[model samples]
Target: MGSPLVSRGFQEFGSALQERRLRLLLAGRSGTGKSATGNSILQRKHFLSRLAATAVTRACATGSCRWASGDVEVLDTPDLFSPEVAQADPGFEERGRCYLLSAPGPHAVLLVTQLGRFTAQDLRAWRGVKALFGAGIAARTIVVFTRREDLAGGSLQQYVRDTDNRALRELVAECGGRCCAFDNRAADGEREAQVRELMGLVEELVRDQGGAPYTNDVYRLAQTLGGLSREERLRRVAERLAAHRELWPLAGFPSWAWPPCWALCCCCAFSAGTCPRR
Candidate 1:
């Protein structure tokens, strides 16, 4: 609703976010245009995208484009979060390698969806993202809607503000009200414009994150610190972070405040009516 953060110089942002290459991860259900969105963001057709009954991206693919004295890397991933692909990465040969390819973790995770086609599966996709990346991942996540033409040039912010979809609105709120649209079919100029818009949002997210990218350590904490309640997990994560503070000390994060930036993820578990009270 205010001025876009695009006009600001990276030198004025929090700490040295400008010094590190910003990494992003593309995620969503099949046919939601994750790969196509990645190509559009990178301004190149590096990932395969097509309509089919089955999945097109079997594993994660990586791409990047330089932006204002730094590079922005993107990982277009498969639907590894789905129950069907739960075991697809047993040996890190498939989607599991995404963890390696994105080594330190992404600065932002784009949970891509199609405009005017929200479904239960869409909400579930957010849950899957939190599960794999740790609930704290929600702190740095962004909801991306493809097929912006469906809006007929209407306002995206207004649409979300007026939508009757409570769960969708909540998911967006959980991500700190960060979302963007993409018209993958736009012309070269408009396509670049859309990418620039997304970069602005990503930069804003990084700034809000205190100039920290979500790290793999949080994901590791998720796997190793299992079976605990949400509160206990948060406590343990805080305790464990002291041992690995060097990993993201530049972000100036506190122990319980996770993902090396802001607060821990409240989780998408609310969609199932099981979300714990804060």
Candidate 2:
């Protein structure tokens, strides 16, 4: 292995090769506020919101957002239990399987659900998610309970402590006891706190995986990529290269040339435009 710093650069380069941006797939039941949570994280209304009874999201919707540290490529998926999606795509389960196997592959997976009712259905949904995404993903997953203000008297900790929701407790334990509550309806100091906590958790998880410490530059790059569409990213890269070309006409070449000139008694002229081999 190379030095830690060099190894980290290689890992980041590998990640970039896979896709120029880190992809996080957000998943949950319909009306669980998964989309709302996404919008909250992105700090913009990117995903479509609806107050319907059934699954509003029929397919995957992707959005990008820039953070102080990095770019976030969030894929808001349809409810795992959406009948239309399941029926339409025979490969849906396979896709879910891939996600499960590759997860935490995402820097993080935000499992959003509403507050108040921790029903058996909800428990089953959580189980399904784990079953599909795989147990490893849970280690990087955070349970973000939306509409947190619904918990009348205390913090989310107190609520969790008081509830007899065994499945929820198990889910939390499985995810390394990482949980956060968010009120997507409003912005507050708590929301910022939650984001910071999530970022810290992500950093810790990546480090535990023997990865390099997350840096501001990496995060900035991610943020820049996150805010762009596929076409836009390519376009920007092209533009940047064009600008660089203007700034440095022979950037990669050195001031020398050889061979033919060596045979022609023009060695001094060759030295003006080519590099000396090491």
Per-candidate Cα RMSD to the true structure, in Å, reads 12.1, 25.6
The residue-by-residue lDDT of candidate 1 on 1-278, one tens digit each, is 12232345652552366445788999877789999999888777889988888889887789977655367789988876654443554433343456656755688999998876665556556766665666788888889999898789899998788776666788889988999999999998888778777877887888887776687665465456557665565556545543543332232223453321111222223433342422
The most accurate candidate by TM-score is: 1
Q: Model 1 misses residue 129 by how many Å?
A: 0.6
Residue 105 in candidate 2, Cα distance off native in Å: 3.1
TM-score of every candidate relative to the true structure: 0.73, 0.61
Q: How well does candidate 1 match the true structure in TM-score terms?
A: 0.73
Full-model lDDT for every candidate: 0.70, 0.55
Where model 2 places Cα greater than 4 Å from the true spot, the runs are 1-22, 81-88, 93-104, 188-190, 212-278
* Candidate 1 CA-lDDT value: 0.70
Question: What stretches of model 1 exceed 4 Å from their correct place?
Answer: 1-15, 90-95, 216-278
Q: Per-residue lDDT tens digits of candidate 2, residues 1-278?
A: 11111234334543534233445567666778888777766667889886887778766677776543345567787755332333444444333332332233566677777776544445545654554444456766778888777765468876666565555677777878777787777655666555555555555555565543222222233346646675554444334333333322221222253222222221122342462311
Q: Tell me how far the alpha carbon of residue 121 in candidate 2 is from the true structure, in angstroms, after superposition.
A: 2.0
